[model samples]
Target: MGKIRIGVIGCGSIAKHRHLPEYAANNEVEIVALCDKVEERAAELAKEYGARSYKDYEELLKSDDIDAVSVCTPNYLHAPISIAALAAGKHVLCEKPMAISEEEAQQMITAAENNNRKLMIAHNQRFVPSHVRAREIIESGEAGKIYSFRTSFGHGGPEGWSADGKDSWFFKKEQAFIGAMGDLGVHKTDLLRYLLGEEFTEVAALVETSAKKGSTVDDSAVCVLKTESGIIGTLAASWSYVAKEDNSTIIYGEKAILRLEEDPAYSLIVQYQTGETVKYELGGIQTNESGGQSNSLVVDHFIDSIRQDTEPAISGAEGLKSLRVVLAALKSNETKKFAEI
Candidate 1:
């Protein structure tokens, strides 16, 4: 249980901007290896971190030096690489939209269980201070029974943010599986589940590729999600927000309406029906615009979980469940009907 020797797969934007920097920041982590199909990409980070680089991730997984890994690959590779890593007896912190399908997600969970290695998903929204506080408030019954909510995550596109720029794999349906729904929608899907503490049982969706010019995958999507408890909400994910970003969530409760990331100053605000307003001055949620700041905290918590021998905040099972919602939404879009999870 000394410092966790970490191997990072995929030196993409999520790795370059978030995972690499965050892993470096964690004192309990010693970033030991870097891997990407693009050799230069892996080597650059290896040189920067004073670690070994491998173009083939399988080779990196074979290394005895690494005790854990951050699977930062594209949507298609998330499950395969994670299963291989878990089989190699290394703990994993896979980036989200955990897998393309729920079956793959289940395989990941099973692999982690069989290997007795921790499997955590990089659902960083759960770590946002506003979200954490909101969960606490809702749990305290200060917000009362949550009846309905609408949460959205949108931006211009992934061109500016992805490691590959305009020609990023994000635009390729084969590599990314789904578009905005995979990139942004799943974040809200995971966040809503965290906030409501309920499992989404059914989904009806309107998935579209109307805005973006080149991608075959969806550019905009609006999914109506209904939980087991009959709690309903609208989840919107888009790459078509050319004017501005709208990464906000509004929850309607019996007592008050809790608004998250709605204002610049107050990250969280609650309005009671009794004509009272309470604003929390917790810092902003790290948006794609603000860059990935809270990502370090995500790495920190993962390392802490390893050190403490505890389960991660977002376990593989929970991540799989979230993936089911997303997959169901995609199904609903395809079938033109409600999809059951």
Candidate 2:
């Protein structure tokens, strides 16, 4: 009823850039614990937020005062940390690419159900105002029957953001499992699912490590997706995009085409088949200071879900759905054929 006592696991880039600052800003939330394998990082964040620090996530999970946790760990730790948090009776908000595999994602979902706790994924793109407005316009039938779509996200590499610079877990296959697909691709996967309101049924993909030297994971990936509703689309994610595009989606329908961009300036351009164009200035949706406003929106939704005893905008099952699409793309790349989701 008061503030949701929160613990943040993995005081890495995401935690520092998004979760910690956003949670600190939420009036209904109080950060009580911070955890990271690197104790110094945890201690640093804790001091900034006036919270306790722990080197072991397990120890943080066992704390009785903490009501919820934000799992900002690498891809591989998502399921384990989430499952443990649920078992410990704490609500969880796990970062994207829910798990390395669907089986692990399912285990996390099952754990949440079994524990009767909230398990939401931090797919923050859903909170982007341009994205939300795009959904509204599409659902309003202004876009008509959806025909196809395309979306992508990319950056120079993880060196700029990863705590370990070039030696971060992002480049390690053992820790990250997949590369740009998991890091940047997953955002588009979830964004498309949210904007189109359709589940991906199949994917044909090509993944490669062409740009970053010494990086074992994929540096670039391009994939085509077939949605259950018969809509087709392509998603391209890369860590090699020298220009650095955040995330963008374009949807083509019978009546209109919608283009949404998150960088330089947030804007939505809609063009009708009748040769009329309408532009929506989405700059207001641009979160102030490091996209923290968007992060705050997402964290606010999670807090509201807990307070209202309802499901979050991005639930665990929804996270699994997006994860499935990413995995299907990987499989398609491996087999060099369309893989059914």
Candidate 3:
């Protein structure tokens, strides 16, 4: 019950940038082991963090000293590794798009539930300061009766962020399953669900592999989502923004138009119907840029959940709900119709 012993099951970009460092910084956690398919990668990180290393995730999960694991692997490997980690009596903090299919996400949830361990999805968007404030403002009726929204998350692509650069598993359809939608769109979807407190019940989308050359997976996607209460919104996810990253959300409501992460100076801006404009200088949203390393709070929250023996804020069920919206968007693209979630 001292520091929660942690194992990170991927030595990739996300692990390097977010999980590993965040967990190491937390006073309640210890970086116990590192795992990756590439032995050198795992070994290097292990040496740096003073932790054990394993080329095989299964081997890493066998250690009883490890109380929790961050499943930072490719999308295809997320479900299996997390399920295994849960079965091994360790809490799991899985990366976004927790599974490629609903069945797999359900199985992960079932495994965690059966094992009586915590399962949290690493949807750090919810932990963004502006997002948290926006949710509060919306719930307090500051944005009274939401009408519509437009949110986007884009950048040059994972080539600049992935550990393998242009050769990362992110561009492969088999490994990533879906690219921008799963990578970026799901964050917005989850954010919207959190901010609005409603599940997306239908989706229509145009998903394509348009931007990245020679890539078999989608690099851009635009989705039209309808919430359970008839609130509609557009979500754009792309790897084609060659200049810079854009992670912004604009919500239109009866009393105000709330903008999040849209201004360079202010993180949240609210323009009321009464001509009063309020701007908030909350901390910057985390980006793939060189020095935009804001604390995402995902790793800390996961550690707290384990320590307190409580369900994580972004639990498996919440992740599954977000995943379903992404899956429905894919289905809508394939079927050329509105897909009900």
Cα deviation of 17, candidate 2, in Å: 1.0
For model 2 the local lDDT of residue 62 reads 81
RMSD, candidate 3, Å: 0.8
TM-scores for the candidates: 0.98, 0.95, 0.99
Residue range with the least summed lDDT across 10 consecutive positions in model 3 = 289-298
**Tens digits of lDDT, candidate 3, 1-341:** 78899999999999998998898789998898999999999999999999999999999988999998999999999999999999999999999999999999999999999999999999999989999999999999888999999999999999999999999999999999989999999999999999999998999999998889989899999999999899999999999999989999999999999999999999999999999999999989899985557789999888888888888988999999999999999999999999999
Worst 10 residues of 1 by lDDT: 287-296
lDDT of 2 by residue, 130-242 (tens): 78898998989888999999887887788777778888999989999999999989888888988988888889999999998888899899998888889998899988877
Q: Name the TM-score of candidate 3.
A: 0.99
Better of 2 and 3 by TM-score: 3
Residue-wise lDDT of candidate 1 within 1-341, one digit each (tens)? 68899999999988888888888887888999999999999998899999999999999989998999999988999999999999999999999989998889999999999999999999889988899999998999998999999999999999988988889999999999999999999999999999999899999999999987888789999999999999998999999999789889999999999999989899999999899999999887777777545654888888888899999989999898888889999899999999999
lDDT of 1: 0.91
Descending-lDDT candidate ranking: 3, 1, 2
Model 3 residue 199 CA deviation (Å) reads 0.8
Best by TM-score: 3
TM-score of candidate 2 on Cα atoms, chains taken together: 0.95
Instruction: Name the regions of candidate 3 deviating beyond 4 angstroms.
Output: none
Go through the candidates in order and give each one's C-alpha lDDT.
0.91, 0.87, 0.94
